[model samples]
Target: MTHSRKILVTGADGFIGSHLTEALVRQGHDVKAFVLYNSFNTWGWLDQCAADIRGHFEVFSGDIRDPYGVRKAMEDCDRVLHLAALIAIPYSYHSPDTYVDTNIKGTLNVLQAARDLGVSKLVHTSTSEVYGTARYVPIDEKHPLQGQSPYSASKIGADQMALSFYRSFETPVSIIRPFNTYGPRQSARAIIPTVITQIASGKESIQLGSLHPTRDFNYIEDTVRGFIAMLESSNSIGEEINIGSNYEINIGDTVSMIAELMNRSVNIVSSDDRKRPEKSEVERLWADHSKAKNLLGWEPLYSGTEGLRKGLEKTIEWFTKPENLSRYKADLYNI
Candidate 1:
């Protein structure tokens, strides 16, 4: 019953998007990858994937903020997976203007182009950070959105714009909100990569921020599966679905587990630079993924510990290579 349709994946060079591109190719779908434009023409994590997998993707380099480029990328495509955005919360603090331009306006450009192209489906990526600190446990779609930081604020604007297109113009869009996706090829700005890299580098002390904040971490593959599931399920249109593992763990506990698995005894020191602003910090996040399960027949396949082990192993392996480790700025705080 699979349609022989061309799928356009924006941000296909990113962590989740790269994984999604591989998944789609494995499922026998034609993939058009819209990578971010750069002078060096880099494809980010997409470069790390196997050459055969890379061969399967038709890559087009362009900026998401450009409407003409976005429209050209969507040409002859049946579905669009919009994953491009400025996601670094810490960087957003210093440059909120960039977030608004990229997260909000970029999404608007994609939506308008998709509507014009009459794409069969559009899946817009969102983050659980939009919900900010949990007012209640097991946050559902009904939870109030608090823009605890500039990054979340921009995402809120983007999500609202996507949903509005769905409601007002029947744009056939689904907002896929994923909670803390962690795995291979993730930027060092993420906690998992940061911890794994520091440990792999033979550091006796690992620097981190507030470790009490809890998050529901979905493995990258499962998060990408949720995106594909939304595309395949007609019921997902006009609906915002949460894709998460539903299990929450404190950052302190997560680091401890990694330490044990890595067989390294390291002291964790809280660095002021690593901590989010007191008012901006999100204390807890646990997703209510029932909507995704019932609607898209999807749920996280990897448990927290299991996913962590896999992520750490892969990250450690990658960072062990000098070439890969050189890509990360382990000496400085990313945001």
Candidate 2:
């Protein structure tokens, strides 16, 4: 928040990118938002953000897979936060080539552009999925990465490409690996939104997949702050830092918690269509955020119940709005 530099955010139209872009504008930074090009001239989540924040952003339409477009977007920017990628795990199973093209090759475009443009810092977004199932309690940076799904495999490829640029060309890069982030504007393909949408749409019985897997869910606001804090810390360059609440809860318990927060109870049914293939599912993920704290002075500000309440409130508010809930087909399985 100190120096107001030109920050380029790829995937500014998506959930996390849109929030990060808005956060940057609120912090008084000049932002250039790179959104995917389309014939409709759609801005995605950027369309829903405040006018003042949108006014501060310079919107450009282009594809991240195009190196030329990526470089053009980075021009005159002091830093870059790469968030564009194919994020749906189930979709990746069908079109893995696209995931590799976007996540891995698209990341290559960003890193190459940053190195060529001499950007001050590049904050690359990573996911906890890269660790697969947790091998030990509080998974840390040193934990072995297991690519259990095509989505995770592509992310692993992307992370390595960014790190290689750091080690080889000395491009200033920090991998901001955030655990599961949920909040308003999230798509129904994700768990929290799926649950909230079902309840909002008046479903008597909630259909879910495997409910045993546990995840460390960070509220979107804290995740955004973690990105800024990581970039602000000079010591974070060339380091991979986790941004997550240390606490985690199982999916079944999370459903109960959400129901409790909403003051509604419903029977939960396991749906075969919602479940992941046995080999592709990640059983557990818990974050060891000690590195982030010791190095970048970062820690999650929201605990589970607090974060869940905030997320569920916003999600319920959004879904209850006729226009917003219409985007999701709650009667059918998203995967």
lDDT of 2 by residue, 37-86 (tens): 99999988998897878678899899999999999888888888889988
Question: What does the lDDT come to for candidate 2?
Answer: 0.89
Model 2 misplacement above 4 A: 1-4
Each model's total of backbone clashes:
0, 0
> What overall lDDT, based on C-alpha atoms, would model 1 receive against the true structure?
0.89
lDDT of 1 by residue, 1-335 (tens): 23337999998899888989999998889999999999987888888887778687799999998999998888878899999998999999899998998999999999998888788899999999999999998999999999999999999999999999999889999999999998777888999888878887788998899999998988788898899899999999999899988889999998988888788988999999989989999999999999999999997888667865676566567666888777888766776
Instruction: Give candidate 1's error at residue 84 in angstroms.
Output: 0.3
Candidate 1, poorest ten consecutive residues by summed lDDT: 307-316
